[model samples]
Target: AQTIHQWPVAEIKAVGSPLSLGCTIKGKSSPNLYWYWQATGGTLQQLFYSITVGQVESVVQLNLSASRPKDDQFILSTEKLLLSHSGFYLCAWSPGQYQDTQYFGPGTRLLVL
Candidate 1:
């Protein structure tokens, strides 16, 4: 059984401050990972994705960045979050070597102040 975890379920941050959010997967190996964001009442947008280690692709560039330091950990962050950066972020994963369904974990909802 595979499970995903995200931290800071909700946050309120100042516009010029730094931000960090985390996601981790358990019970899955070499999974395909993705980061997605949804603005207030807006549709979800793909931010980044990794098919394997050291290989990440950007689907959309919202002036944000992501990194995968481990097989099961992906991080999304920004040095300065703009007012437009406020949104709900979700981490998702698919089984390795298979085009299986992608599953989203509990997401982090952020509001910029």
Candidate 2:
């Protein structure tokens, strides 16, 4: 059975500080992973996607970065946190194949202070 896990349920950070969030998908190899952010205004935006380990592509311009350091792990990091970056984040994954269904793990809520 495949399971995806995202860490740190929430965070409150000051502006201009660095941040990192991690996700790991077990029982799958080279899963296609995605990072999503939903702002306080209720926009569900996709930030990044990874098709394989060590390769990540940005889907939108959100001033954030993502990487896959392991076949089962994905990381999202930012050098600085912005007020506009405050949002609820979701990490999702799909089997690394065409037309597979995607599933989301419990997310992290970020509040910028």
Which has the greatest lDDT? 1
| lDDT (Cα, 0-100) at 112 in candidate 2 | 92
Q: Please report, as a residue range, the 10-residue window in candidate 1 with the lowest summed lDDT.
A: 94-103
What is the C-alpha lDDT profile of model 2 across 1-113, one tens digit per residue?
98888888999999999999999899987789999999876977889998988899999987899989988888999999889899999999998678578899899999999
For candidate 2, give the lDDT of residue 14.
99
Could you tell me which residue pairs clash in candidate 2?
none
Per-residue error (Å), model 2, residue 90? 0.6
In model 1, where do residues sit more than 4 Å from their true spots?
A: none
Question: On a 0 to 1 TM-score scale, where does candidate 2 land against the true structure?
Answer: 0.94
Question: lDDT per residue, candidate 1, 1-113, as tens digits?
Answer: 99999998999999988999999999998999999999878888889999887678899888788889999999898999899999899999999676768999899999999
**Looking at model 1, how many pairs of residues clash?**
0
TM-score for candidate 1: 0.94
